[model samples]
Target: MKANGPFKILALLFVTVLAFYLIAYHTIEGRRNRNGPWIVAFTNDLSGAPALRIDHPALAITNVQLVFPDAMLPTNFTAKTILFQRPRPVPFPLPMGECIFMDTTFLPGSVVMRMSGHEVQLIPRVLTINGREQPWKSGETIALTAILTNAISPRLNGR
Candidate 1:
Protein backbone atom coordinates (compact mmCIF):
# COMPACT_ATOMS: atom_id res chain seq x y z
CA MET A 1 0.00 0.00 0.00
CA LYS A 2 1.19 3.46 -0.81
CA ALA A 3 2.19 5.58 2.20
CA ASN A 4 -0.27 8.33 3.24
CA GLY A 5 1.98 10.51 5.38
CA PRO A 6 0.03 13.73 4.80
CA PHE A 7 -3.25 12.21 5.92
CA LYS A 8 -1.69 10.80 9.09
CA ILE A 9 -0.13 14.10 10.07
CA LEU A 10 -3.41 15.94 9.48
CA ALA A 11 -5.29 13.46 11.62
CA LEU A 12 -2.77 13.83 14.41
CA LEU A 13 -3.09 17.60 14.30
CA PHE A 14 -6.84 17.40 14.42
CA VAL A 15 -6.80 15.12 17.45
CA THR A 16 -4.32 17.36 19.23
CA VAL A 17 -6.43 20.45 18.63
CA LEU A 18 -9.55 18.73 19.81
CA ALA A 19 -7.87 17.52 22.99
CA PHE A 20 -6.56 20.99 23.79
CA TYR A 21 -9.96 22.54 23.28
CA LEU A 22 -11.64 20.01 25.54
CA ILE A 23 -9.08 20.49 28.29
CA ALA A 24 -9.40 24.23 28.21
CA TYR A 25 -13.17 24.09 28.16
CA HIS A 26 -13.31 21.87 31.23
CA THR A 27 -10.79 23.93 33.15
CA ILE A 28 -12.79 27.10 32.62
CA GLU A 29 -16.08 25.39 33.39
CA GLY A 30 -14.62 24.00 36.60
CA ARG A 31 -13.74 27.48 37.83
CA ARG A 32 -17.06 28.84 36.70
CA ASN A 33 -18.75 27.81 39.94
CA ARG A 34 -16.03 29.08 42.22
CA ASN A 35 -17.35 31.44 44.88
CA GLY A 36 -16.20 35.01 45.29
CA PRO A 37 -17.14 37.89 47.54
CA TRP A 38 -20.02 39.94 46.24
CA ILE A 39 -19.54 43.66 46.16
CA VAL A 40 -22.72 45.73 46.42
CA ALA A 41 -23.61 46.58 42.84
CA PHE A 42 -24.78 50.16 42.25
CA THR A 43 -27.49 48.94 39.95
CA ASN A 44 -30.53 50.89 38.73
CA ASP A 45 -32.96 48.48 40.30
CA LEU A 46 -35.34 50.65 42.37
CA SER A 47 -37.01 47.55 43.72
CA GLY A 48 -34.64 47.68 46.70
CA ALA A 49 -33.65 50.05 49.44
CA PRO A 50 -31.32 52.98 48.81
CA ALA A 51 -33.39 52.97 45.68
CA LEU A 52 -32.17 55.55 43.22
CA ARG A 53 -34.87 58.04 42.28
CA ILE A 54 -34.09 60.24 39.33
CA ASP A 55 -34.26 64.02 39.98
CA HIS A 56 -33.73 63.53 43.69
CA PRO A 57 -30.69 65.50 44.75
CA ALA A 58 -29.34 62.36 46.40
CA LEU A 59 -29.91 60.63 43.14
CA ALA A 60 -26.86 62.57 42.27
CA ILE A 61 -25.18 59.35 43.30
CA THR A 62 -25.30 57.55 40.01
CA ASN A 63 -22.92 54.89 38.86
CA VAL A 64 -21.20 53.26 41.84
CA GLN A 65 -18.09 51.10 41.28
CA LEU A 66 -14.84 50.19 42.94
CA VAL A 67 -11.38 50.66 41.51
CA PHE A 68 -8.51 48.40 42.38
CA PRO A 69 -4.81 48.02 41.73
CA ASP A 70 -3.40 46.21 38.73
CA ALA A 71 -0.31 44.59 40.19
CA MET A 72 -2.32 42.43 42.52
CA LEU A 73 -4.44 39.43 41.69
CA PRO A 74 -8.12 40.27 42.30
CA THR A 75 -8.74 36.88 43.90
CA ASN A 76 -6.95 38.06 47.05
CA PHE A 77 -7.60 41.76 47.38
CA THR A 78 -10.17 44.27 48.64
CA ALA A 79 -11.19 47.81 47.77
CA LYS A 80 -10.57 50.76 50.08
CA THR A 81 -12.77 53.31 48.34
CA ILE A 82 -15.89 53.20 46.23
CA LEU A 83 -16.39 55.51 43.20
CA PHE A 84 -19.62 56.77 41.72
CA GLN A 85 -20.76 59.12 38.97
CA ARG A 86 -23.06 61.91 40.05
CA PRO A 87 -25.96 63.45 38.13
CA ARG A 88 -26.16 60.66 35.59
CA PRO A 89 -28.86 58.32 34.40
CA VAL A 90 -30.31 55.64 36.63
CA PRO A 91 -30.70 51.85 36.28
CA PHE A 92 -27.16 51.29 35.14
CA PRO A 93 -25.99 48.25 33.22
CA LEU A 94 -24.48 45.00 34.43
CA PRO A 95 -20.94 43.65 34.89
CA MET A 96 -21.00 47.18 36.32
CA GLY A 97 -18.68 48.49 33.56
CA GLU A 98 -16.07 48.71 36.38
CA CYS A 99 -13.84 46.47 38.40
CA ILE A 100 -15.14 45.60 41.84
CA PHE A 101 -12.97 44.62 44.75
CA MET A 102 -12.35 40.91 45.11
CA ASP A 103 -13.29 40.93 48.76
CA THR A 104 -16.82 40.43 49.97
CA THR A 105 -16.41 42.78 52.91
CA PHE A 106 -17.60 45.53 50.59
CA LEU A 107 -20.60 43.59 49.33
CA PRO A 108 -21.79 40.51 51.19
CA GLY A 109 -23.94 38.74 48.64
CA SER A 110 -21.30 36.08 48.01
CA VAL A 111 -21.62 36.68 44.29
CA VAL A 112 -18.76 37.34 41.98
CA MET A 113 -18.62 40.63 40.07
CA ARG A 114 -16.91 39.62 36.88
CA MET A 115 -14.58 42.55 36.20
CA SER A 116 -13.78 44.37 33.03
CA GLY A 117 -10.60 43.61 31.13
CA HIS A 118 -9.14 47.10 31.69
CA GLU A 119 -7.13 48.01 34.77
CA VAL A 120 -6.55 51.28 36.67
CA GLN A 121 -5.78 52.60 40.13
CA LEU A 122 -7.36 55.34 42.16
CA ILE A 123 -5.45 58.23 43.65
CA PRO A 124 -5.81 58.99 47.32
CA ARG A 125 -8.93 61.06 47.96
CA VAL A 126 -11.17 62.15 50.81
CA LEU A 127 -14.91 61.69 51.25
CA THR A 128 -16.62 64.16 53.52
CA ILE A 129 -20.34 64.39 53.95
CA ASN A 130 -21.07 68.10 54.46
CA GLY A 131 -17.54 68.72 55.69
CA ARG A 132 -17.53 65.45 57.63
CA GLU A 133 -16.82 61.91 56.54
CA GLN A 134 -19.73 59.81 55.33
CA PRO A 135 -19.20 56.40 56.83
CA TRP A 136 -21.80 53.77 56.19
CA LYS A 137 -22.62 50.37 57.62
CA SER A 138 -25.24 48.21 56.06
CA GLY A 139 -28.42 48.14 58.18
CA GLU A 140 -27.60 51.46 59.81
CA THR A 141 -28.90 54.86 58.73
CA ILE A 142 -26.82 58.01 58.69
CA ALA A 143 -26.53 61.13 56.54
CA LEU A 144 -23.90 63.70 55.61
CA THR A 145 -22.28 65.59 52.72
CA ALA A 146 -19.39 63.87 51.05
CA ILE A 147 -16.73 65.17 48.62
CA LEU A 148 -15.84 62.55 46.02
CA THR A 149 -13.72 62.47 42.89
CA ASN A 150 -10.08 63.37 42.44
CA ALA A 151 -10.47 66.92 41.18
CA ILE A 152 -11.29 70.24 42.74
CA SER A 153 -15.07 70.69 43.02
CA PRO A 154 -15.38 67.11 41.82
CA ARG A 155 -18.51 67.30 43.84
CA LEU A 156 -21.60 66.55 41.77
CA ASN A 157 -24.46 69.02 41.62
CA GLY A 158 -21.92 71.87 41.83
CA ARG A 159 -21.25 71.40 45.50
Candidate 2:
Protein backbone atom coordinates (compact mmCIF):
# COMPACT_ATOMS: atom_id res chain seq x y z
CA MET A 1 0.00 0.00 0.00
CA LYS A 2 2.81 2.41 0.88
CA ALA A 3 4.67 1.78 -2.38
CA ASN A 4 1.49 2.58 -4.39
CA GLY A 5 1.03 5.95 -2.68
CA PRO A 6 3.75 7.76 -4.70
CA PHE A 7 2.57 6.22 -7.92
CA LYS A 8 -0.97 7.43 -7.29
CA ILE A 9 0.24 10.92 -6.50
CA LEU A 10 2.26 11.10 -9.72
CA ALA A 11 -0.73 9.87 -11.71
CA LEU A 12 -2.94 12.53 -10.18
CA LEU A 13 -0.36 15.22 -10.93
CA PHE A 14 -0.11 14.16 -14.53
CA VAL A 15 -3.89 14.17 -14.90
CA THR A 16 -4.12 17.65 -13.41
CA VAL A 17 -1.57 18.98 -15.87
CA LEU A 18 -3.36 17.33 -18.75
CA ALA A 19 -6.66 18.84 -17.69
CA PHE A 20 -5.16 22.29 -17.60
CA TYR A 21 -3.65 21.89 -21.03
CA LEU A 22 -6.92 20.67 -22.45
CA ILE A 23 -8.80 23.57 -20.96
CA ALA A 24 -6.30 26.11 -22.20
CA TYR A 25 -5.73 24.95 -25.75
CA HIS A 26 -8.72 22.86 -26.73
CA THR A 27 -11.63 24.49 -28.54
CA ILE A 28 -15.11 23.04 -28.80
CA GLU A 29 -16.68 22.89 -32.24
CA GLY A 30 -20.04 21.65 -33.42
CA ARG A 31 -22.39 21.59 -36.34
CA ARG A 32 -23.66 24.96 -37.65
CA ASN A 33 -20.84 26.55 -35.74
CA ARG A 34 -18.46 29.14 -37.12
CA ASN A 35 -14.94 27.81 -37.45
CA GLY A 36 -13.33 31.20 -37.64
CA PRO A 37 -14.40 34.80 -37.89
CA TRP A 38 -16.33 34.64 -41.15
CA ILE A 39 -17.47 32.34 -43.96
CA VAL A 40 -18.82 33.00 -47.50
CA ALA A 41 -21.09 30.93 -49.68
CA PHE A 42 -23.40 31.06 -52.72
CA THR A 43 -26.53 29.26 -53.78
CA ASN A 44 -27.29 27.38 -56.97
CA ASP A 45 -30.18 29.51 -58.17
CA LEU A 46 -29.02 32.66 -59.89
CA SER A 47 -29.39 34.35 -63.26
CA GLY A 48 -26.66 36.92 -63.21
CA ALA A 49 -22.96 37.31 -63.79
CA PRO A 50 -20.60 35.55 -61.41
CA ALA A 51 -20.47 38.01 -58.54
CA LEU A 52 -20.31 37.57 -54.78
CA ARG A 53 -22.89 39.54 -52.79
CA ILE A 54 -21.76 39.76 -49.22
CA ASP A 55 -24.05 41.41 -46.68
CA HIS A 56 -21.15 42.90 -44.77
CA PRO A 57 -18.18 43.40 -47.02
CA ALA A 58 -16.02 44.48 -44.12
CA LEU A 59 -14.85 41.09 -42.83
CA ALA A 60 -11.71 40.08 -44.69
CA ILE A 61 -12.21 36.79 -46.39
CA THR A 62 -9.76 34.20 -45.13
CA ASN A 63 -10.90 31.46 -47.45
CA VAL A 64 -12.44 31.34 -50.90
CA GLN A 65 -13.87 28.47 -52.92
CA LEU A 66 -14.81 28.23 -56.58
CA VAL A 67 -17.04 25.41 -57.86
CA PHE A 68 -17.09 24.97 -61.60
CA PRO A 69 -17.11 22.38 -64.32
CA ASP A 70 -13.70 22.24 -65.96
CA ALA A 71 -12.61 19.58 -68.43
CA MET A 72 -15.68 17.55 -67.55
CA LEU A 73 -14.65 17.57 -63.91
CA PRO A 74 -16.62 19.21 -61.11
CA THR A 75 -13.65 21.02 -59.72
CA ASN A 76 -13.80 22.77 -56.38
CA PHE A 77 -10.86 25.13 -56.19
CA THR A 78 -10.09 26.62 -52.80
CA ALA A 79 -7.74 29.41 -51.77
CA LYS A 80 -6.69 30.79 -48.42
CA THR A 81 -5.36 34.34 -48.08
CA ILE A 82 -3.48 36.06 -45.35
CA LEU A 83 -5.55 38.57 -43.41
CA PHE A 84 -5.63 41.91 -45.19
CA GLN A 85 -7.44 45.21 -45.15
CA ARG A 86 -10.89 44.45 -46.50
CA PRO A 87 -12.25 46.62 -49.25
CA ARG A 88 -15.91 46.78 -50.14
CA PRO A 89 -16.91 44.65 -53.08
CA VAL A 90 -13.65 42.87 -52.42
CA PRO A 91 -11.80 41.92 -55.56
CA PHE A 92 -12.17 38.16 -55.19
CA PRO A 93 -12.51 36.23 -58.38
CA LEU A 94 -15.84 34.48 -59.00
CA PRO A 95 -15.21 32.35 -62.02
CA MET A 96 -18.37 32.20 -64.08
CA GLY A 97 -20.23 28.88 -64.10
CA GLU A 98 -18.93 28.31 -60.57
CA CYS A 99 -20.84 28.67 -57.29
CA ILE A 100 -20.12 29.82 -53.75
CA PHE A 101 -21.02 28.14 -50.50
CA MET A 102 -22.58 30.72 -48.12
CA ASP A 103 -21.48 29.27 -44.82
CA THR A 104 -20.40 32.49 -43.14
CA THR A 105 -18.34 30.95 -40.36
CA PHE A 106 -17.08 27.57 -41.52
CA LEU A 107 -17.57 25.16 -44.35
CA PRO A 108 -19.81 22.26 -43.25
CA GLY A 109 -22.83 20.48 -44.58
CA SER A 110 -22.35 18.93 -47.98
CA VAL A 111 -24.41 17.80 -50.91
CA VAL A 112 -23.39 14.27 -51.83
CA MET A 113 -23.69 14.72 -55.54
CA ARG A 114 -24.10 11.26 -56.98
CA MET A 115 -22.54 12.18 -60.29
CA SER A 116 -19.70 14.29 -58.94
CA GLY A 117 -19.49 12.65 -55.51
CA HIS A 118 -19.17 16.01 -53.76
CA GLU A 119 -20.75 19.46 -53.49
CA VAL A 120 -20.89 22.29 -50.94
CA GLN A 121 -23.68 23.48 -48.64
CA LEU A 122 -24.08 26.92 -47.17
CA ILE A 123 -26.24 28.13 -44.28
CA PRO A 124 -26.61 31.80 -45.08
CA ARG A 125 -26.96 33.91 -41.97
CA VAL A 126 -26.79 37.12 -43.97
CA LEU A 127 -27.77 37.90 -47.50
CA THR A 128 -27.50 40.90 -49.85
CA ILE A 129 -28.57 41.85 -53.33
CA ASN A 130 -27.53 45.05 -55.09
CA GLY A 131 -26.00 46.20 -51.81
CA ARG A 132 -29.29 45.83 -49.96
CA GLU A 133 -29.90 43.44 -47.10
CA GLN A 134 -32.48 40.74 -47.67
CA PRO A 135 -33.77 37.61 -45.95
CA TRP A 136 -31.96 34.55 -47.29
CA LYS A 137 -32.99 31.01 -46.66
CA SER A 138 -32.11 27.34 -46.12
CA GLY A 139 -30.70 27.03 -49.61
CA GLU A 140 -30.22 29.48 -52.46
CA THR A 141 -28.19 29.51 -55.66
CA ILE A 142 -26.25 32.47 -56.96
CA ALA A 143 -24.84 32.43 -60.44
CA LEU A 144 -21.17 33.11 -61.04
CA THR A 145 -19.49 35.18 -63.74
CA ALA A 146 -19.07 32.50 -66.40
CA ILE A 147 -21.77 30.31 -67.85
CA LEU A 148 -21.86 26.51 -68.17
CA THR A 149 -23.30 25.33 -71.43
CA ASN A 150 -23.70 21.59 -71.90
CA ALA A 151 -21.09 21.19 -69.24
CA ILE A 152 -22.78 18.24 -67.63
CA SER A 153 -23.58 15.17 -69.62
CA PRO A 154 -27.25 14.70 -70.42
CA ARG A 155 -27.35 11.66 -68.16
CA LEU A 156 -25.84 13.66 -65.31
CA ASN A 157 -28.59 16.26 -65.36
CA GLY A 158 -31.17 13.48 -65.42
CA ARG A 159 -31.94 13.31 -69.10
Candidate 3:
Protein backbone atom coordinates (compact mmCIF):
# COMPACT_ATOMS: atom_id res chain seq x y z
CA MET A 1 0.00 0.00 0.00
CA LYS A 2 1.18 3.58 -0.65
CA ALA A 3 0.42 4.87 2.90
CA ASN A 4 -1.83 7.75 1.75
CA GLY A 5 -2.21 9.32 5.19
CA PRO A 6 -2.65 12.92 4.01
CA PHE A 7 -5.27 11.92 1.43
CA LYS A 8 -7.35 10.07 4.06
CA ILE A 9 -7.17 12.99 6.46
CA LEU A 10 -8.34 15.42 3.76
CA ALA A 11 -11.18 13.11 2.78
CA LEU A 12 -12.39 12.86 6.39
CA LEU A 13 -12.25 16.62 6.82
CA PHE A 14 -14.33 17.11 3.65
CA VAL A 15 -16.99 14.73 4.91
CA THR A 16 -17.21 16.51 8.24
CA VAL A 17 -17.67 19.89 6.55
CA LEU A 18 -20.33 18.47 4.30
CA ALA A 19 -22.31 17.19 7.30
CA PHE A 20 -22.21 20.60 8.94
CA TYR A 21 -23.33 22.38 5.80
CA LEU A 22 -26.16 19.93 5.11
CA ILE A 23 -27.46 19.20 8.62
CA ALA A 24 -26.40 21.93 11.02
CA TYR A 25 -26.49 24.92 8.67
CA HIS A 26 -30.18 25.88 8.45
CA THR A 27 -29.65 29.01 6.36
CA ILE A 28 -29.64 31.27 9.42
CA GLU A 29 -28.10 33.85 7.21
CA GLY A 30 -27.74 37.62 7.51
CA ARG A 31 -30.56 40.17 7.54
CA ARG A 32 -29.77 41.54 4.11
CA ASN A 33 -33.25 40.76 2.78
CA ARG A 34 -35.22 42.02 5.78
CA ASN A 35 -37.89 44.61 4.82
CA GLY A 36 -41.17 44.29 6.72
CA PRO A 37 -43.52 45.11 9.54
CA TRP A 38 -46.43 45.55 7.17
CA ILE A 39 -49.75 46.42 8.78
CA VAL A 40 -52.00 44.42 6.51
CA ALA A 41 -55.75 43.71 6.76
CA PHE A 42 -57.66 40.47 6.51
CA THR A 43 -61.12 39.18 7.32
CA ASN A 44 -62.10 36.23 9.45
CA ASP A 45 -61.58 33.69 6.69
CA LEU A 46 -59.12 30.99 7.58
CA SER A 47 -58.74 30.09 3.91
CA GLY A 48 -57.28 33.58 3.38
CA ALA A 49 -55.90 34.19 6.81
CA PRO A 50 -54.77 37.45 8.41
CA ALA A 51 -58.18 36.82 9.80
CA LEU A 52 -59.70 38.46 12.86
CA ARG A 53 -62.91 36.53 13.52
CA ILE A 54 -61.52 33.30 14.90
CA ASP A 55 -61.94 34.53 18.47
CA HIS A 56 -65.24 36.35 18.19
CA PRO A 57 -68.76 35.22 19.14
CA ALA A 58 -69.42 34.72 15.44
CA LEU A 59 -67.17 32.32 13.60
CA ALA A 60 -67.53 34.02 10.23
CA ILE A 61 -68.20 37.27 8.39
CA THR A 62 -71.20 37.71 6.07
CA ASN A 63 -71.96 39.89 3.05
CA VAL A 64 -68.34 40.91 2.74
CA GLN A 65 -67.52 43.52 0.11
CA LEU A 66 -64.00 45.01 -0.11
CA VAL A 67 -62.82 48.10 -1.96
CA PHE A 68 -59.44 49.66 -2.70
CA PRO A 69 -59.44 53.30 -3.73
CA ASP A 70 -55.96 53.13 -5.27
CA ALA A 71 -55.94 49.45 -6.16
CA MET A 72 -53.25 48.98 -3.49
CA LEU A 73 -52.40 49.45 0.14
CA PRO A 74 -48.95 50.34 1.40
CA THR A 75 -46.91 48.03 3.60
CA ASN A 76 -45.28 49.36 6.74
CA PHE A 77 -41.77 48.05 7.22
CA THR A 78 -39.89 48.67 10.41
CA ALA A 79 -36.36 48.14 11.64
CA LYS A 80 -34.94 44.61 11.54
CA THR A 81 -33.84 44.44 15.12
CA ILE A 82 -34.34 41.84 17.84
CA LEU A 83 -36.70 44.25 19.58
CA PHE A 84 -39.77 43.14 17.68
CA GLN A 85 -43.32 44.19 18.50
CA ARG A 86 -46.68 42.49 18.04
CA PRO A 87 -48.86 39.40 18.66
CA ARG A 88 -47.71 36.09 17.17
CA PRO A 89 -44.92 37.61 15.12
CA VAL A 90 -43.36 35.30 12.58
CA PRO A 91 -40.03 33.86 13.66
CA PHE A 92 -38.69 34.03 10.11
CA PRO A 93 -38.59 36.63 7.35
CA LEU A 94 -40.75 36.77 4.22
CA PRO A 95 -40.26 34.55 1.10
CA MET A 96 -39.73 31.83 3.68
CA GLY A 97 -43.51 31.85 4.35
CA GLU A 98 -46.45 34.29 4.39
CA CYS A 99 -50.18 34.87 3.85
CA ILE A 100 -51.51 36.19 0.55
CA PHE A 101 -55.15 36.96 -0.25
CA MET A 102 -57.38 39.26 -2.26
CA ASP A 103 -58.80 42.51 -0.96
CA THR A 104 -61.95 40.75 0.21
CA THR A 105 -60.69 37.32 1.31
CA PHE A 106 -58.10 35.69 3.51
CA LEU A 107 -55.16 33.41 2.81
CA PRO A 108 -52.87 31.46 5.10
CA GLY A 109 -49.04 31.57 4.99
CA SER A 110 -49.34 34.41 2.51
CA VAL A 111 -46.93 36.79 4.14
CA VAL A 112 -48.30 40.30 3.63
CA MET A 113 -45.01 41.75 4.79
CA ARG A 114 -41.97 41.08 6.94
CA MET A 115 -39.33 42.75 9.11
CA SER A 116 -36.02 41.64 10.56
CA GLY A 117 -36.96 38.21 11.86
CA HIS A 118 -40.68 38.68 12.33
CA GLU A 119 -43.76 38.92 10.12
CA VAL A 120 -47.10 40.74 10.29
CA GLN A 121 -49.46 37.90 11.09
CA LEU A 122 -53.21 38.52 10.98
CA ILE A 123 -55.18 37.03 13.82
CA PRO A 124 -58.51 37.46 15.58
CA ARG A 125 -58.33 40.61 17.64
CA VAL A 126 -59.91 44.03 18.02
CA LEU A 127 -58.11 46.41 15.70
CA THR A 128 -58.21 50.13 16.40
CA ILE A 129 -58.62 52.50 13.49
CA ASN A 130 -56.48 55.52 14.13
CA GLY A 131 -58.41 57.82 11.83
CA ARG A 132 -61.89 57.22 13.19
CA GLU A 133 -60.73 56.24 16.69
CA GLN A 134 -62.92 53.21 16.16
CA PRO A 135 -62.30 49.68 17.23
CA TRP A 136 -62.99 47.05 14.59
CA LYS A 137 -65.02 44.18 15.95
CA SER A 138 -63.55 40.73 15.74
CA GLY A 139 -66.18 39.21 13.46
CA GLU A 140 -67.38 42.24 11.56
CA THR A 141 -67.36 41.75 7.82
CA ILE A 142 -66.16 45.20 6.89
CA ALA A 143 -64.95 46.01 3.42
CA LEU A 144 -61.15 45.85 3.50
CA THR A 145 -58.05 45.90 1.32
CA ALA A 146 -54.42 45.00 2.02
CA ILE A 147 -51.40 46.05 0.03
CA LEU A 148 -47.87 44.87 0.76
CA THR A 149 -44.94 47.25 0.42
CA ASN A 150 -41.37 47.74 1.55
CA ALA A 151 -41.23 51.16 3.14
CA ILE A 152 -37.55 50.59 3.79
CA SER A 153 -36.66 49.46 0.28
CA PRO A 154 -38.87 50.37 -2.63
CA ARG A 155 -37.02 47.89 -4.81
CA LEU A 156 -38.34 45.02 -2.75
CA ASN A 157 -41.89 46.32 -3.12
CA GLY A 158 -41.89 45.05 -6.72
CA ARG A 159 -43.98 47.37 -8.88
Candidate 4:
Protein backbone atom coordinates (compact mmCIF):
# COMPACT_ATOMS: atom_id res chain seq x y z
CA MET A 1 0.00 0.00 0.00
CA LYS A 2 1.25 3.50 -0.78
CA ALA A 3 0.82 6.51 1.56
CA ASN A 4 -0.42 9.95 0.44
CA GLY A 5 1.83 13.07 0.81
CA PRO A 6 -1.09 15.49 1.11
CA PHE A 7 -2.49 13.50 4.07
CA LYS A 8 0.81 13.85 6.00
CA ILE A 9 0.88 17.58 5.40
CA LEU A 10 -2.69 17.90 6.56
CA ALA A 11 -1.97 15.95 9.72
CA LEU A 12 0.96 18.23 10.59
CA LEU A 13 -1.15 21.32 10.01
CA PHE A 14 -3.85 20.05 12.31
CA VAL A 15 -1.32 19.48 15.14
CA THR A 16 0.15 22.95 14.74
CA VAL A 17 -3.30 24.57 14.89
CA LEU A 18 -4.26 22.59 17.96
CA ALA A 19 -1.09 23.65 19.82
CA PHE A 20 -1.67 27.32 19.10
CA TYR A 21 -5.30 27.14 20.17
CA LEU A 22 -4.40 25.47 23.44
CA ILE A 23 -1.79 28.07 24.26
CA ALA A 24 -4.13 30.98 23.63
CA TYR A 25 -6.95 29.42 25.62
CA HIS A 26 -4.66 28.81 28.60
CA THR A 27 -3.38 32.35 28.57
CA ILE A 28 -6.84 33.83 28.66
CA GLU A 29 -8.49 31.48 31.16
CA GLY A 30 -5.61 30.54 33.51
CA ARG A 31 -5.28 33.89 35.21
CA ARG A 32 -4.77 33.17 38.91
CA ASN A 33 -6.62 34.92 41.72
CA ARG A 34 -5.49 38.51 42.29
CA ASN A 35 -6.74 41.11 44.80
CA GLY A 36 -5.61 44.47 46.20
CA PRO A 37 -5.41 45.83 49.76
CA TRP A 38 -8.00 47.88 51.64
CA ILE A 39 -7.62 51.51 52.71
CA VAL A 40 -10.25 53.81 54.20
CA ALA A 41 -10.43 57.05 56.20
CA PHE A 42 -12.29 57.60 59.47
CA THR A 43 -14.81 60.17 58.29
CA ASN A 44 -15.93 60.98 61.82
CA ASP A 45 -14.97 60.73 65.48
CA LEU A 46 -16.57 59.15 68.55
CA SER A 47 -16.07 60.52 72.06
CA GLY A 48 -12.61 62.04 71.46
CA ALA A 49 -10.67 59.63 69.27
CA PRO A 50 -11.36 59.08 65.58
CA ALA A 51 -13.26 55.81 65.07
CA LEU A 52 -15.58 53.96 62.71
CA ARG A 53 -18.76 53.01 64.45
CA ILE A 54 -20.31 50.82 61.74
CA ASP A 55 -23.71 51.74 63.11
CA HIS A 56 -25.31 53.45 60.15
CA PRO A 57 -28.10 51.11 58.93
CA ALA A 58 -25.87 48.17 59.99
CA LEU A 59 -22.56 47.82 58.17
CA ALA A 60 -20.96 44.42 58.33
CA ILE A 61 -17.37 43.40 57.58
CA THR A 62 -17.00 39.85 56.35
CA ASN A 63 -13.75 37.87 56.47
CA VAL A 64 -11.96 40.67 58.27
CA GLN A 65 -8.26 39.89 58.89
CA LEU A 66 -6.68 42.68 60.91
CA VAL A 67 -2.95 43.11 60.25
CA PHE A 68 -1.55 45.29 63.00
CA PRO A 69 2.10 46.22 63.33
CA ASP A 70 4.46 43.73 64.97
CA ALA A 71 5.23 46.30 67.63
CA MET A 72 1.59 46.48 68.85
CA LEU A 73 0.92 44.76 72.12
CA PRO A 74 0.50 41.02 71.97
CA THR A 75 -3.00 39.57 71.63
CA ASN A 76 -2.92 37.83 74.99
CA PHE A 77 -1.82 40.98 76.79
CA THR A 78 -4.50 43.07 75.16
CA ALA A 79 -7.15 40.57 76.22
CA LYS A 80 -5.93 40.75 79.77
CA THR A 81 -6.10 44.56 80.15
CA ILE A 82 -8.75 45.78 77.74
CA LEU A 83 -12.44 45.23 78.28
CA PHE A 84 -14.07 44.42 74.95
CA GLN A 85 -17.81 44.60 74.51
CA ARG A 86 -19.93 43.91 71.47
CA PRO A 87 -23.58 44.19 70.58
CA ARG A 88 -25.91 41.24 71.03
CA PRO A 89 -25.30 38.80 68.17
CA VAL A 90 -28.53 39.48 66.33
CA PRO A 91 -27.64 39.01 62.70
CA PHE A 92 -25.19 39.97 60.00
CA PRO A 93 -24.22 43.63 59.50
CA LEU A 94 -25.01 44.87 63.01
CA PRO A 95 -24.59 48.44 64.23
CA MET A 96 -21.06 49.83 63.88
CA GLY A 97 -19.92 51.78 66.92
CA GLU A 98 -22.60 52.89 69.33
CA CYS A 99 -23.58 49.33 70.20
CA ILE A 100 -20.02 48.35 71.15
CA PHE A 101 -17.94 49.79 73.95
CA MET A 102 -14.48 49.32 75.45
CA ASP A 103 -14.86 50.04 79.16
CA THR A 104 -12.03 51.91 80.89
CA THR A 105 -11.86 49.26 83.56
CA PHE A 106 -8.59 47.61 82.61
CA LEU A 107 -9.84 44.99 84.99
CA PRO A 108 -8.01 41.98 83.56
CA GLY A 109 -6.95 42.80 80.01
CA SER A 110 -5.68 46.27 79.31
CA VAL A 111 -4.85 46.74 75.62
CA VAL A 112 -4.38 50.43 76.30
CA MET A 113 -1.53 50.14 78.78
CA ARG A 114 0.01 47.30 76.84
CA MET A 115 -0.37 49.24 73.63
CA SER A 116 0.75 52.53 75.17
CA GLY A 117 3.58 50.70 76.92
CA HIS A 118 5.52 51.27 73.74
CA GLU A 119 6.68 54.82 73.23
CA VAL A 120 5.42 55.14 69.66
CA GLN A 121 2.50 53.61 67.78
CA LEU A 122 3.08 52.46 64.25
CA ILE A 123 1.22 54.29 61.46
CA PRO A 124 -1.01 52.96 58.70
CA ARG A 125 -2.52 49.89 60.28
CA VAL A 126 -2.94 47.35 57.48
CA LEU A 127 -6.43 45.82 57.23
CA THR A 128 -8.01 43.58 54.59
CA ILE A 129 -10.03 45.79 52.25
CA ASN A 130 -13.28 44.17 51.06
CA GLY A 131 -11.97 40.78 52.15
CA ARG A 132 -9.22 41.06 49.56
CA GLU A 133 -5.69 39.68 49.95
CA GLN A 134 -3.81 42.98 49.64
CA PRO A 135 -2.53 45.29 52.35
CA TRP A 136 -3.93 48.79 52.79
CA LYS A 137 -2.21 51.79 51.20
CA SER A 138 -0.68 54.60 53.25
CA GLY A 139 0.43 57.00 50.54
CA GLU A 140 3.34 58.88 52.17
CA THR A 141 1.43 58.69 55.47
CA ILE A 142 -1.64 57.14 57.16
CA ALA A 143 -4.11 59.11 55.07
CA LEU A 144 -6.70 59.15 57.85
CA THR A 145 -7.11 58.21 61.49
CA ALA A 146 -8.14 54.52 61.38
CA ILE A 147 -9.33 53.20 64.68
CA LEU A 148 -9.50 49.42 64.46
CA THR A 149 -13.00 49.32 65.91
CA ASN A 150 -14.44 45.87 65.20
CA ALA A 151 -12.02 43.06 64.50
CA ILE A 152 -14.37 40.05 64.20
CA SER A 153 -12.12 37.05 64.63
CA PRO A 154 -12.53 33.66 66.32
CA ARG A 155 -8.86 32.86 66.83
CA LEU A 156 -8.04 35.99 68.85
CA ASN A 157 -10.75 37.46 71.06
CA GLY A 158 -10.94 40.90 72.75
CA ARG A 159 -10.99 43.82 70.25
Name every residue pair that clashes in candidate 1: 44-91, 128-145, 128-146, 129-145, 129-146, 130-145
Candidate 1 lDDT score relative to the true structure: 0.33
lDDT of 1 by residue, 1-159 (tens): 336888898999999999999999887754542322222433222222221111111213322323322222334233232323222233333333333323222212112222333322221122222233333322332221122435555476476
Best by lDDT: 2
List runs of model 1 lying over 4 Å from the truth: 36-145, 148-159
Per-residue C-alpha lDDT of model 3 across residues 33-120, encoded as one tens digit per residue: 1322223333324333223221222323222222222222225422221211233543443322243321211221122333222233
**Model 2 lDDT tens row, 98-131:** 2332223333321111112223232234334323
| lDDT, candidate 4, 1-159, per-residue tens | 247788888999999999999998776544321111112222222222322211111112222212222223223331211112222332222112121212212211111111111111111232322222244332222113234445568657753
Q: Give the lDDT of residue 109 in candidate 4.
A: 14
The 10-residue segment with the lowest total lDDT in model 4 = 108-117
Q: What root-mean-square deviation over C-alphas does model 1 reach?
A: 15.4
What lDDT does the true structure give each of the candidates?
A: 0.33, 0.35, 0.33, 0.28
Stretches off by above 4 angstroms in model 3 are 1-3, 26-66, 69-159
- The clash count of every prediction, one per candidate, is 6, 16, 13, 14
- Choose 1 or 4, whichever is better by TM-score: 1
lDDT of 2 at 41: 36
